[model samples]
Every structure is written in C-alpha cells, then in structure tokens.
Target: MLRIAVPNKGSLSEPAVQLLKEAGYSQRRDGRALVHVDERNDVEFFYLRPRDVAVYVGQGIVDVGITGRDLLIDSGAPAIEHLELGFGGSTFRYAAPAGVAASVQDIHGKRVATSYPRLVTEHLAQFGVEADVVRLDGAVESSVRLGVADVVADVVSTGTTLRAAGLDIFGDPILKSEAVLIRDERSDAEKIAVLTGRLRGVLTARRFVLVDYDVPGDRLEEAIAVSPGFEAPTVTPLHGSDWQAVRVMVPRADINDIMDRLYAVGARAILATELLAVRV
Candidate 1:
C-alpha cells in the first residue's frame, strides 16, 4: 500500500483531495478525519498541516506529501519534488511601506518581517545582504505598520493585501510557488511511480477535453487539420454513407477556436466533453 500525506487545511487541501478522488482513490468526506484507508486501491492517507508535510515526507514518516513549494524550502527538508501540482499558487516577495526601499539592496541592515523566515534569510544571503528578519505567525504585511519591522517578505497572490496595508512590492520575486507532490530523497521508487502515474492522469484530464465532430468523408482530412490530437485522430465511418465522424482530444484553451475552424471546414455536430480521467 502507498502512504500519502495530504494538507489538512489552507488553500491546498480541497484541491488535493479532489485530485485523489478523480484518480479513483477514496478520500475522507470530512476534513476532520485524520486518516483514511482506501482498501480498494491499497493506499493510506494521513492529513497534516501543509508546512509539516515536507518534514514528514523528508523524515520517511510518509511515502509522499503534497505541500506548497515555499513551505518545503522554508522547512529545509530533504524531499525531492515528485510532481508539480499546479494549484495553491502564490508568489513569495519582499514588500515595504510604499517607497521605503527601491530594491532588495536598499533594505540591507534593516528589519524585515515574514512568516517565512528561513526563505527570507536564504534569499537575502544570495544577494550577500543580511538584515534583521522578524518572524511573525501571520498578518506579516501589518508588521511594518505596527513597528515590528521596516519591510516584509511574504506571499503575494493579487497584491491587494499589500496595497491595502499601504505597502508596495519591490525587487524581482523571491520565489514563484504552487502546491507540489514531494517524496523523501530515498524512497520506494516503484511504489511512488504507481501513485505518480495515477495523479498524472488526473492532471492531464483537467488540462484537455475530448472533441467529437462529423464531416463529409472528403472533408475529413481538412477537419482533422484543425484539431489533430496528441495521437492520431479517431476516425470512424457514418451509418448511411459519404460521411465520417472524427474524435480527438484537444487542450481546453484551444477548444473554442478548434470548434470554429472545424465548422468552417465543413464539419457538423461538433462537441467537446470534460474528461473525468485519462491514462495518457
């Protein structure tokens, strides 16, 4: 059985659970459930705080974990990213009360507040600049106003929170982050690959859709040119003659344009379906 650690709360939890459910694994219906056993799949899931996920996986307490990339870096855990989950997205950046520092260099020897102290310290080290890093539990953006620190390093999603607090972002982003699957540097490779393959199927399903359409047999080649799939398009003959049906998978972002082109090229009955799951 594969052992998995999932986020207990915050932005990453729900989507992580949904991904597992989509991969044909059983997940606990209630958030308070500490552990769940998917007997059919021979997997066990443990719910833990997002920040602690990397530690557990790194310590070999769990075979794999899902956590924010930022948290993993801050924890300094010995875990390798098994896959990028593409959710719980955010940016880690340095901000200050509007115009305090023009760049990261200007903030040298000043106070910087952050929930992610380790990441902030490590980032500044790369620039050969060190400062007083004030660690706060939450509401890091307010630390500057409250006089705990002159500048702040924290997660910026829309920049609204920073602006509301009269802060402005400065410097290049410290780190771009999103939720990711992680495993200890040393682990059971074959078992991890099985779980990784299942999740990859879910990720692929979310990214693409199934498209079906009909066209005159002669125009089939033309229609296919509009939406050729990753593999060869599935072409089939129609019931009464002179026509054929075509089916292919296309990226969700290009579906509307593909539909338009297929129709213009003499295709009919075009349809696209949301894929629940895919293997490849």
Candidate 2:
C-alpha cells in the first residue's frame, strides 16, 4: 500500500483533506486520528506536522507528503517536489522599520529575526551580507520593536502582520511559496504517479467548468474558434439537420467571455456546469 503524509494542522490541512476526498479517497473523520487506512485504494495516510512532513518522506518513513514549499526547503531534506498543490501561498521576505532599512544590504551587520532562520541565512549569503539570525517561533515581526532584532525575514501572506508591527517589506522576495507534494527521490514511482494524477484531476476540475452549446452547422467553425477546449471541442449532430451541439471545457475565469463570443457567432442554448471531478 502507498503511504502518504499529510499536514495534521495549520493552513494546508483542511484543503489537503478536501482535495483527497474530492479525488475519491476516504479521509479520517476524527481530526485527531494519527493515521487512516483506505483499504479500497491500498493506501495509508499519516497525519503529521507541516514542518516535519518533508523530513518524514525524505527518510522513507512515508512515501510522499503534502507541505508548504517553504517548509520543505527549510528542512533541507532529501525530497523532491512532485507537484505544486497551489494553496497556502505566501512570500518569504525581509522587512524592517518603515523608514529605517531600505534594502537587504541595510541589514548588513544587523540582527534579523525569523521563524525560518536557515532560509533567511542562505538568502542573505547571496547578497554577501552576514547578519545575526535571531530565531523565533512566531510573532517574528514584533522582534524589531522589542529590540530582539533590527530586521526580520519571515512569511508574508497579505503583509497585514508586517504592517501591524510597524514594519515594511523591502528587497525582492526570498522565495514565493505555496503548498506542494514532496516525495523521496527514490519512492515508488508508479504509486506516487497514481495519487499525483488523481490530485491533478481534482485541481483541474476546480479551475474549469464544462461548457455546452449549439450552433448552426454553417457557423460551427466560427464558434469552435472561440471555445477550443483543452484538446479539441466535442461536436455532435443535433436534432435539427442544420445545427450541431458542442461540448468543451472552459477555464472558470474565461467562461463569461467565451459565452459572449459564442453567442455573437450564432450559437444558442449555451450552458456552463461545474465539474465535480475528472481524470482527464
């Protein structure tokens, strides 16, 4: 059976489970359950802290894990990012007192506070700056006010936390992070591919909708140009000899514009429906 590690708490947990469930895998109903076995799929899920997920997978304790890209890199484990899961998005950056430090070089010879000390240290090295790294578990933004550090390099989601602490982000982001699937370099390839494919399908389903419309046979070519799908739109004969039905997948963001274009090209009975799940 394939063993998978999932974040047990924090921002990625709920969405991770929801995605798995949407992909037709059974999830543990009890939040505290350490492990859940999905016998039908021949898989086992191990609940773990987000930071430790990459390590567990890298050590061969679990076949693969779902964790934030920042956490995965900070751990420095022997794992490869199998796929980007696209949630828990944030930026790791350097911030300091609004009018004090204007760039990363300004923090040279100064102390910087952060939960991710390794990431901060490595990034600073690239700029030839050597600043003391004050490691804090949380509330890293407050370190500057409290005099624990002159600056901070930490996660910035909306920058609200940085603003609340009277800090301003400066310099280019150290890393742009989001949730991702990680696996040991030598994990079971076939099994991992299966799970990855399923998750990919669910993500695709969430980002697009099925579009169906009918067009006069004479105008079919024009309408097809407007809604050419992932591969090609499916065309079928309609009851009226002079008309045809077309089915295609449209990205959720482009649905309205595609609809208007189809309408302008002599299409009718246009419909868009959300996809529950998909394999292709």
lDDT of 2: 0.92
lDDT of 2 by residue, 123-222 (tens): 8899999999999999898899899999989988889989998998899999999999999877889998899899999899988999999999999999
lDDT of 1 by residue, 1-280 (tens): 7889999999899999989888888999876999999998888999999999999999998999999999999999898887998788899888887668979898899999999989999999999998999989999988888999999998988999999999989999999999999998677899888888989988998889999999999998888888889687999999988899888999999999999999999999999999987887
Inter-residue clash pairs, candidate 2: none
TM-score of 2: 0.97
lDDT of candidates 1 onward, in order? 0.91, 0.92
